[model samples]
Target: MSAFGAWTTAHGLPAFSYTMDQERDPRAEWDPILEPPTRRHAVHLGNRRITLVADNYGLSGLFDEHTALRWLTRDTGVTRVGELSTDISGSERIFGPTFVIVRVADDQVSLERTVLCPEGEAPWVLIRLRVRNLLGEPARLTLTEEWAARPAQVNLISGTAPSTGPDEDVGLELELIGGARPRRTGSGRLAVPLLLAAHGERVVELRYGLLDDTAPSFEGSLAALRDRLPRASAPRAPEAEREIPWHAALLTGAACADGVLGGHTLDQGSCYSFRHGFNGAARDPLQHALPLVYIEPDLALSVLRNTCAWGSPDGDLPYALGPDKQPWTDLFRPSDQNLWALWLAAEYLSATGEEAAFREPVPYHPLHRAAPVPLGEHLRRQFRFFTDVVGRGEHGHVRMLNADWNDMAITESGVDRELMIAQGESVLNSAMAAWVLPRYAVLAERLGDLVTAAEARKLGEELRGLVAEEWNGRWFRRAYGPGAVVGDSDMWLEVQPWAILCGATPPGRAAELLRRIEATAAAGSPLGARLRWPVREHHGPGGVGTIWYAINMTLIWAAADHVPELGWQWWRRMSLAAHANAYPDVWEGTLSGPDAYLAPETDRPGRTWDLADLGIAMQAYPVANLHSHSQPLLAYLRLLGVEPFSERAGTGDGARFASRALTVGP
Candidate 1:
């Protein structure tokens, strides 16, 4: 076993251990767009995203809107131990929730490098290198580090014209402590001298990050930052299951704290290859903050407040917030945006029991100079938007204006999108509203708003009946449209779980639907469940026969509500261990993966960024830090019997463990 394996075993966590001597790919090339280095781990804090490759190479650069301004690559930081001539060899790497450890050793000396980006308001990365002497007699050692810093810009989005921005000076800055004064050997190079007693250990600390105006100053000591680094508090579960929450924390934490958006706002993720590091989605921040309510309630509350601030006076939310902190609303009109805000506000209040939050005044979008309103008023506007602005269809289901949760649902070929947007109805959104409104009504009643509470309960009951009418004997239909009904013949996995969760399906019928889902959708892929069964081709990305992490997470939640054993089984199937075992060649699958996975039948099995019909073979959007990370964290909590809404409604206890141990069943 490697050092990482030993550490994981000692700590009761699963190990994704690698020995570089055998696993390192010597032929791997470096290209940010087409063939970037595989097996990479990134750390994020405040406004910076730093990546380190598997073979101890660093992708050192300053992040911009579309790509990175490179200061150095490949040999970003090369360190030599002993005699200043001996090379460091025999490397091993291990990944933790928020950190990565790399160990290299020679016959006379050993070095362990721990890299971390602590959680705080500063944008910086810390590298602590500990070197130990193995000789019986006192040894003289010299440490030399070198890097070639040449500033150049690389465009990650292929075939598009490069974006021009303001000219700014950006480079890598380094500060070293606990060693002799560093001597500048050459350009972008520093050498530190050290002497150690026999079998003695010495520590060298390197604080290096981007030096730009966007980065804030750090007044605290390096030791203070290191001490505040986020550590994983293991949940009570099987040894293999403990790593799920740890991975969830790392991915969620990595996507948070984009100071440009808001102090507590979360970006999509730090996956530069995917071009999602800097933007914020209206619905994503609410989902991403769900896990934080348990770990950090104050930060979670701040996220709720910041997300609510993006609402307009008419209660419409922008599709997404750009890197410039501007709203993008010209693309599509999504009807499900406000629904998420209402749902999250209720969840936050239920989990924390912070009734005082309702009275806190929050401003509208900065573009609108309207007076601030109480948080409760913001939530009420969201509810009214659904009831008035985006009114119901003829069938009493929520209007699908352009699209709903499935962005690609009404975007198929040969369909008049305008007509469909005007008349289409989404059963998925209806089920969600049916589930969210009544629960939110309880909170409203507690806050002494009887009128809104009564109105909410009436609307919720009406939508539930409308949803029940859409059942097609076997399962629920996805949507109602003029051209052809979706999920009419084929079963859509997204809506069925929601139907069971919201009590729209009868008890016996819900059980039958879940069993059929297990036989079809869940059986489609060995890696959890597919989005739909009886795969059909569509126009663009994420058509059919795909396993989306966000959708499947809801499946786990509903399954845990009815059948705990089956829920645990599906949860294990979607585990990182399962992904690694299935696709050993894909590096991201082992550490982290994209938001969705192509089914086994696709050309790129277990991989993302496959748009073959559009003449794009693979665009290299590999890294994902979206709801995929957050939903799993929420699902795991649900499996542990933490149902906040139910607990607050006096139906169950919040954050309590299940009556018996949950184990994987055959």
Candidate 2:
């Protein structure tokens, strides 16, 4: 069944939409416009961005502070809006409110505009402006399009100087088409009359682009813009088939000028920083690449190769892998990253029928000695480090040198290097290891390494059993720390779900554990699920009861593990959050995109556009990879006995109900 049909049947209908009508006649239906310089209602097109708030203003870059376009009334030489009433709408084109700006004066010449990010990499924004004669008599309406080059040094190495007086000469240029030519001022401002009509209604197609090598033409640009809308408005794929187009668009947006992937912050055409740089994250790109390998095999292969290519001498993947690497906390090496590499490599082989990748050599250095090893051999070495080296602890789980995914350190000093073994074993990381190792073992056996395969399978089973012991009858304890469980006082929602995904949770106890999660971790908030239930005084960096997309995703995976209906609910909540509603079209609580992590419950519905929110939003796009072929909607479909990819032969029962939509085969 179509995703829309299923959604409507299950949840009535989607509460959000794009069309909002003011007063309509045979002449025109004045759709609400997003006012200028808006915080929440902004549509990004390439580097050019337009915020729909009280005024029709825009800037360049995904989430930049530079004001590239500001609305000005040319007829009266006035800027900004007078008075307004807002009606919000959301669609696949953009997710925000549409607005109608009233002049609030004697003239009362109202301007209605709608902005959208047209599909394509061309650096241009599309805005539809409609001017109406609201008064009894005809009115002369002329709106000015202002373009200015503000002098601001963002991400400058030597630090930015305070704005010297306005006399600090900055070069600016402007080109207007399909409207009256704009006049340029020496102060880096260009004003163009956008709408000039004294009749029933006048519509102007405003296509604006930043300065580039080729001048943008109305015909070429407009054609490109119109072509994208059809695809964006194409029939919604079925539940299990959504990710195909979803990730394609997201990955297209994720492309950097330097040919690398970065986000969870910023959007398409935005500059990359230390946080979301090409070499920034060793694990994030790999994580993104896991499910992505199914569609964009070459792109996913490149990301995996980049991670493996940049490994440290000890086969340790750094926390960040960019040219200008900046680690969030360098105290502990991330053991999970290397494991992720092996898992991805195994997945790559499973997805594609290519075995040349296995024989391909990758550069490595364990003791700073330069040597290249085959890709398969490199992955085996990394898996050994993950298990034999970093996986050491008295608790028989992976040792938390500093932090796992939770990063739940109880002290200001972070995890002590000397006391790491004594502190606790990472149940989350170990559980993941328990899950991925068996898959890796299968790959090894296929590659003629029976010894490694046998050993990995044995260790994987042992680790799975060890992690299962942490199940405290209700939910799994966070970790086995010194003399006690670290988070035994309350549930750390992040780690518990992994046992379900990794096949460590017993069948009899799985249902009860999910119930506990729903009661504690997922309760109280419509912002999906929190990382924990009750807030600890200072739960360290991961913090107490903060909402993270990672945990929310795991919640869906666990829900898919047992109850498909629960998975659908979580997916609906995430969809509602993205569409600016919690339930239906009723706009009440917080309107947030799928962000990296919301602040702890103490902060309530935290800032919407912070920390990789777009990255999280991409996961909901249905095509973007969520690791293990495990998209929430796809998992639900799988639970409903639907096989989207029934062309291939199934591997085993383990492949039957796993989160992965694509099984291990070519």
Candidate 3:
């Protein structure tokens, strides 16, 4: 049995726990057995930001962009019956919504250490150590805490940066409460002595404050801050699937913050290679907020508005927003960024039924300084940009500016990037636009915008027709460019399911394509579907022998209606439990996983995969809280038939779009 399963059964607590007792391969340079399993949670209040990471051992690090500090060593000294000893037993970790509890127990005493980063602008993380004397006789104990400051780069590129910086002097303020006065043992070390009666218990609290310009001084007691911490509720699911949504919310919630470029924005991810805090992606927040629409509608709406605010006056959206909210205009030049706005707007409206929100005025990008326009106008501008500015190619498909949803699609060998950008067309984006544009038109018509509604429907129909023409009798061609047609011989998993989901494929053809996908993409994998069959030898990232959560989740969404059993099966295969089971010794895949997983065919099966040209050796990024979490949660909801965009808006069927509100337990 897995450590989590054993822990849950032993404690009978409705919490998720993972123990690090599994043996790993000795040859692996990064040993999961010795390395601590870490979880990083972000606390953002106004402009101040602090990220705290607690591992199974204890509180590991507290950091921001400019500061990083962690406990170097924790030693416990216990004297019982006039005998002094210095030894500690192994530890077990339990993960709560906003905190982690690391418990260490022995014959003499039981020590439970809880680390919490409370929400709001407080610049401190609270550490509570509860000690209970297990012996019948009185016990004298001393706890020594040692801390050191590491280079800030250690935390900065905790995401995907190539290297770290030199160690620098960073200051940390430690305030202790309810313990004997700490004696200075050595530089960056303190020893606290405590006397306990027979079978007595005592609690010690430490507030580690960050010394940064953005961080504000603590105004209340640590207990008060703990009391004020927001309580989160997890959505109800079957016992087997319950933890999925809970952990999804926990990770995605850590990526979100207020007082960003746009109010209530979400970052791409929170830790490891995914750590791009303060940097926002236009497509990521939309996908991240999809599941949130059912859990937290108001927050989801705010995210939608925030994403809309990232649009320029010319209706062009940035691939990403940097720390200062500056647009990274030329980053990959993805053509599908603007289309996501329309897709999300449709989902938001269907889920909330808030027609009036479309009329609310929202400012354009701060770079433009343009007058605020209605939310509906922002979406219309996006539609206009695609239909008028970008326009269709000779084949009537939408223009692929550098790339589409597959950022690396145009980067394959022998393909001229410039030529592809100038004339390439994305069938995937065309299919997506075909699916979303009509739905958006339905919304536009409901808002009494007849012209836009008609225009959207027309373009959607034209794109659908163009996409259908690219069908290669087996699966739809991936894209049209200077190089050989992508996915012509080998089926590209990304676009095939989309064609079915968007209703572009005929009913019979959709079923045929799905069956083919199951036989090729789905059948070849032990954990979820593969990106393509007979893996591409000279392909870019995501081309072959990889499974991206975002793309496969779409497969689940599409299969839910047609292949119900396959949908659930594929969903389970992509789940955290499945990854944990497949790679019990890999810490990154045990608790959380990367955005994409390398298939069994790859050199490092069950590990993370990205940047195919860089080789698999360089792309095994550690697990980070990413939109991968949100995609599975959203797909699960879809599998449960909780679709927000099922009903066609403004269709003469007289059926109003309806949505079921889902709430997490508190």
Candidate 4:
């Protein structure tokens, strides 16, 4: 790209887009119109109609601020803007009823409220207009009072209590334990005939103190007395002269960490990809996968444990799992999910020393990083699901089922096991075997269970041998599905040859995969290529690629560990390749492309967890070598190293170069 293009990339500015709705509508059903400036012109509100814009994007739907992915990753630093400031009462508990904050990148919103009568000295509640423009257009759109909230709050689900079924009045995720009749504050929406547009922000806000409390239930202490959280402050470039380095570091870290999670989870995980053609936006797991990696180690371990528990006595993670918990195969494939998550888990465990954290239990609360106490047995079982059952490799060669990351639905019936393997293509289960066996071996030995340790090592060796034998030498097969065999070299498959089973791949094959990756045939990208074959299958709306930042990071790390000589080059290549998500929280995957779409998990019912693990991908950057893969990596790569990446190249080097450019007191 050009210097201007490079600048646009580093700063989260859009490079190119189809400006008109007509051009946009033909391709995607649910195209993500992220910039308030770009989409506001297309939206119109009818009387009494509030079409939630954020809901379409995997958020939890509590206030505009609540998101599905972040809920699970709550403990991680990636979170809502409201979290950064005080609520109305100046307390964490009290937040606005009118609007809610999502990621910190969304620091402010432009609220449109109609000034009301009885406007005394206090005039009910003081309206705060929060403006945020994702387009990098330098200005806040100020919406005069058009609506207000007595106790402002975006509509969000509360508590995971048993649902009495879907009711229009109550949120599915939220629960009002005791008699809780939320007050009626006559909160109104801003009139729409007067459609106004800021260069970049859509007017959204919250309200409070405009009316009297209608109900005495649900404890005012928990609801009314909680101090209001301060609104997320807008960072003015001029005023932020000193904070640039800090913010830049944080923003870059968020992006790199998320890159490690490429193609991991099925829910929101499916939404990540880098295909720039037809299947450009095909849903996969990587998007939020890695962010979750860094944010919560225990959570990542739980996911691994689940994968391990699923191993069919013979060892194989299944194709996929329905939100309802049914097994799915034939749709999306989990080739990398099981393995990647497992490797990430083991690697994370080693770094964080979160064994005690894992003993705590399941339901794998994405929101909380370290559970206070051990989780119950039932929860543990859930965690062990992937570790213990799904694929046993029973009838055939420790075969695996063919299901994509989401594993929710692919419409398969009377399915048996598949027996196809290809090189440069470390299938999901195989990847799992490589990542888990070593750790399990160490763990089993520590517990003094000789048999268990032996079995673990046996499993690891068995997988390593199988991968070397099955992979078609150059590339790996897509799946062990019906008759079709996708034999092509994919970049994602490149990592296992190195990162897994203590580098089981032979020197020649390892070099081949690295070369393919560097050449961009396997993992091509303006930023980075995706492992997606049949780019013809690029998913959803637009004509964008499936590249995900998290996946790129994983490949780079694996290369650093295995290829060594070539690792730094790929490292430099990838370091300059991340121009996707503009939320300050890395690209969920190349965002500008028409392909980016919501993952199946985001479409699932009830509350959901965001992919905070992706936030940790950056932790591996500055390693002198691959001494520590998780925390220590994070410390050196993201926080410790000199500039953390491409140290020899120095500052002001490339377009994507995340320059600290500052000296901080912290």
Best candidate, TM-score-wise? 1
Clashing pairs in 3: 159-272, 159-273, 233-665
Better of 3 and 4 by lDDT: 3
| Candidate 3 TM-score to native | 0.80
Per-prediction TM-score to the true structure, in the order listed = 0.82, 0.63, 0.80, 0.46
Query: What RMSD, rounded to one decimal, does every model reach?
Result: 5.7, 9.9, 6.8, 15.0
Ranking by TM-score: 1, 3, 2, 4
lDDT of each: 0.61, 0.46, 0.61, 0.29
In order of lDDT, best first, we have 1, 3, 2, 4
**TM-score winner between candidates 2 and 3:** 3
Per-residue CA lDDT of model 2 for 553-656, tens digit only, reads 66776666586566656655454233333322212112222233343355424322222323311111111122212233233333333321234333222322
| Global fold similarity of model 2 (TM-score) | 0.63
Model 3 agreement with the true structure over 455-528: per-residue lDDT tens digits? 99988888888888878888898887764576787777888877887777787787677778878877757678
Worst lDDT 10-window in candidate 1: 657-666
lDDT of 1 by residue, 1-666 (tens): 221123252123333454443335542322234343544443322222443332323223323321222323333555678642212334566655444566777678888766555445434455667888988878888876554444434333243313334333345566564336632222445566779889999888665545323322222333333332223222223423444445544544454343433435654553332243224458877777776666566666777777887778777777766445566676567888888887777877877788898888887877888788888888888888888999898788898998787767777412468777988988999998889898889878878989989998998889889889889888898887766577778887888888888889887787788778788888757677777777765313446767877888888888776766677677676766667667765544555566777778776677664453432323354454555567666677666655656641111322232211122121
* Model 3 worst lDDT run, 10 consecutive residues: 71-80
Q: Could you tell me the lDDT of residue 513 within candidate 4?
A: 65
